[model samples]
Target: MLVTGGLGFVGSHVCVALAEAGYDIVALDNLANARLSVLARLREIAGRRISFVRADVRDGRALAQVFRRRPVAAVLHFAGLKAVHESVAQPLEYYDTNVGGTLTLLRAMRQHDVRRLVFSSSCTVYGAPESLPLTETHPLRPANPYGRTKMIAEGLIADCAAAWPELKYALLRYFNPVGAHPSGRIGEDPLGVPNNLFPYIAQVAVGRRAKLNVWGGDYDTQDGTGVRDYIHVMDLAAGHVAALARLESQPESFTVNLGTGRGYSVLEVVKTFERVCGRPIPYEIRERRAGDLAQSWADATLAERLLGWRARYGLEDMCRDAWRWQSLNPDGYPERPVSAAETRRRRSRRRS
Candidate 1:
């Protein structure tokens, strides 16, 4: 198995799952948004050493070299810029890395005759859902540049599969992935300020940041805040393994949604985190942001039918595991000794 972006949050977790299932892993990552130390953590978690390739998917020659050196069975493509807000600011970069990078990887795969792939797609491809509980058949009208790139990449994969009947692909459209490994050794680590809700809230709860800014609070939802389907990262990782297993026997192309089929509002998440962390998370309601949806979840029945998988973790587990990682490593990987005053500040802010 060749897992791109293996040092990242989702990729690392998927590596652990794949390794545990006795698959040999050859991971390639650019280290632009991830840390090399994550590979060490994965090795520790998987109880085996994994082959590491420090290269980007956009580098065609490097990708070709990897395929020539190793007899890889399948590729799990996870390398891409994911921040929605940042993509809006840097549309070209998003397209270059997400779409162009995939094109490069696909070309290399085609050259090597390694046609099996499990793509990491997003529910964002659905944009603002026309109806609740989005299904795999939902129209894909991506709102942001990031989502648009994913949609286009999915299209490319579909076309490639159509052109070559031998090519098999599984497009796993993921919901909002949260939580960390229960061991707290591996987790999500955004380079700069986090754009996602869970990490931002974890930072506030851990005192890395001040108050959590509920992005859009006036939405027509239960708490007037945007609602999303938050699936545990580990569960999402397992879904990938299932997708691969299903692909092995069927050898057919498919698309499925990996989610809990339940939605949680921003305020509900804050309350859950407060209860789990035993501290108050001070947050204020702000204006609804453009392109923000009131609510979005998934119809995960397709995944269950196709991959024999369904999300088991609930919102509390997501919060508890996330807090474990945040509280343990106030500063993420490359664990630095934080001063007592800084730790106290984080704790004190929760009281405010």
Candidate 2:
């Protein structure tokens, strides 16, 4: 299998799942927002070396090279710019990487006769939701450029599937993915500021960051804060495996919401973090973030009915594993280690 952006936060966890499930992983990542040190950790957790390719999904030639080297049965395309705030500032880059990258990858797959894909989509496609427990049939009205890009990519995949009857695609619209591998060796190590709440709170607990910024504590919820369906990253990873198995069995395209069918408020998460880490998470309520939804969880009925998959981890598991990862790598991952081949090549160039 070929997994684009497989070294990223959720992608890395999926790599561990795929590897442990006895699948030979051919992972492609540009390290644009990830770490190569993660590769070592992935190996540690996976108990085997994963073939790595340092390349972007937008480059067709680079993608084709990866395909030439391996007979990929399917692809899990997680390669995209995903920050809602960043997407607002850089819509072009978001569209280019997220939409254009999927186009380039699909074309390459068609050429290679690899027609199966598991796309990473977002619940932001629901756009503040007309009702609670967003379902797959819910109208798609993306609020941010990042969400817009995912909507566009899903459309493109749907169109491609319509044109080719043999194409099998699974569009997984995920809610907030939290937690880390149980091993704690591989987890979310975001570059710069984190857009998600899990990493932000973990950083605060680890003392790397000063305090957590609670975005808008005036919403109507259990604690006057937003509530979301935060699925554990490992459960989310297993959902991908389930989707892959389904696609391999049937020659059809489908979409599902991968979530826990439960909601947790921001203050609830902070309290959970405090309980798990045994530390006070200092926080100051700030203005609501733009494009922020007050409450949104998943129905997740279709995912369970079709894929036979449902999230197993709850808030406590999420908090405990996240704290483990944060304590282990308080400063995030170390600098990328140099491979022996890369070191030798540099030395030879210097000698000449």
Candidate 3:
């Protein structure tokens, strides 16, 4: 198995799942938004070294080299720019990385005669929901560049599958993925400010941030704040394993939503984290983020039926596991090594 962006939050968790499933894994990452330190943690938890290739998926040569070096049964593509607001500001970069990287990876798979792919897709492709509890049949109406890129990549995969009848693929559309691995050894560690609510709350609980920003307190939800279906990262990782298993067994291609069929308001999540950590999470209600939905969950029945997969962890578990990770890793991942001169400069400033 070859996993692109294998060092990232979701990718790293899925790597653990893949390893436990007895797959010989080669993790390909550019460290664009991930840490090389994660490889050590993965090894610690997985009980073996996972092969790694530090190369961008968008680089055709690097991808081709990976395929040529060894035999890959399938490819799990997770490399891409994921921030919605960042995508809005730099649509070209998103297109270049997300769409272009998928295209490059597919080409490499084709060249290598690798026929299976499990793609990392997002529910943002559904846009503002016309209905609650979105199903696989929900219309593709992406509201932002990040979502559009994913939608486009999904199309590309479908089109490739149509052209190559031998190809089998799984497009996993995820809602908000939260929490950490149960061990808390490996978990979501965003580089800067977190783009998702769960990590932001955890950061505040850990004193990494001053307070939580609860966007939109005037919505039509239970708490008048945004509500989303938050699934544990472990469950989401298991979904990937299930999808890969199905693709290996079946010839047909499919798409499914990986989420709990429920929603939690922002205030609810903050309170839950506070209770778990035994710390008060200070928060402020701000203007609703543009393109923010009042509420959206998932109808994950298809996943349960098709892949025999259902989310096991609920909101409390999500918060508990996330707090474990956050409390343990108060500074998130460790920083990259700095120059000796830079270290001395820091010490000199302290002395002065």
Candidate 4:
């Protein structure tokens, strides 16, 4: 198996699950929003070596060389810019990296004769969802550039599958992925300010930030805050493994939603985190975010039926496990220290 963005938050967890399932992995990542130290942490957690390549998914030549060096049974596509607000600011980068990158990867897979792919998609495809408990057959209408890229990528996969009848693909549309590896070794460590709720809250609890700003509290939900389906990171990882198994066994393309089928409001999450961490999470209600939906959960019946997978962790579990990782690594991961020679060279330049 090959995992793009394997060094990232969800991808790393998926790699751990794949390792536990007895699969040798070749992970390729650009490390744009990740660190090399995670490779060591993943090795520690997997108890096995994972061959890694430091390259971007958009580099087709690099991907082809990777395929030539070793035969890959499947490709787990997880690389792309994921921040919604950031996407709103820079749509072109998102399209090039997310959509164009997938195109490059698809071409490489074709050249290498690899037929299996497990795509990491989002529930954002069902933007401004009309109803609660979103189903797999829900309409396709994304609200942001980040989500639009995913939707376009999904379409490309579908088109490729249509042309190549023998190809098998699994489009796993999941909800909000929270929490971390129970070991607390590898977790969500976004660069700069986080664009998600849990990370912001976790950082505040860890004293890295002063307070968390609740996105919207005027919504028509309990506590008047937005509601979302927050699934544990491990559960999301396990869902990917299950989807891969199904793709390997079945020779057809399919789509499924990975979520707990339950919704939690912003205030509920804060209260839960407060109880779990034994600290007050200072938050203030603010205007709604631009691309946010008031309430969006999942009808994960399709996932359960297709892959025999359903989220096993709930709200409290997510809060507790997330706090564990945040508390352990208040400052996400340490950057490599500068070498003495390099430091001296910089100092010499400054003096000159």
Clashes of 1: 0
Model 4 lDDT per residue over 1-352, tens place: 9999999989999999999999999999887888878999999999999999878899999999999999899999999889888899999999999999899999999989999999999999889888778998889899999889999999999999899877799999989999999999888887778889999999999999998888888889988998999999999999988988888787778999999999999999999999999999998888887777889999999999989998899899999999999999999987643344665797799999
Give candidate 2's error at residue 88 in angstroms. Answer: 0.5
Report how far off residue 207 is in candidate 1 (Å): 1.0
What is candidate 4's local distance difference test score?
0.91
What TM-score does candidate 2 get on C-alpha atoms?
A: 0.96
List candidate 1 segments past 4 Å from native: 335-352
Per-residue lDDT value at 307 in model 3: 98
- The estimated TM-scores of all candidates read 0.94, 0.96, 0.95, 0.95
Point to the candidate with the largest TM-score: 2
lDDT of 3 by residue, 284-309 (tens): 99998888889999999999999999
Counting clashing residue pairs in each candidate, in order, gives 0, 0, 0, 0
The models' CA-based lDDT, in order, is 0.91, 0.92, 0.91, 0.91
Name every residue pair that clashes in candidate 1.
none
RMSD to the hidden true structure, all candidates? 7.6, 2.3, 4.7, 3.9
The better-scoring model by lDDT among 3 and 4 is: 3
C-alpha-based local distance difference test score of model 2? 0.92
Error of 3 at 242 (Å): 0.5
Worst 10 residues of 3 by lDDT: 335-344
lDDT of 1 by residue, 1-352 (tens): 9999888889999999999999999999887777767888899999988999888899999999999998989999999999898899999999999999999999999999997999999999998899989999999999999999999999999988888878899999999999999988988877678889999999999988899888777778887888999999999999999999999998888999999999999999999999999989999887778878889999999999888899989999999999998888888998433344655797799999
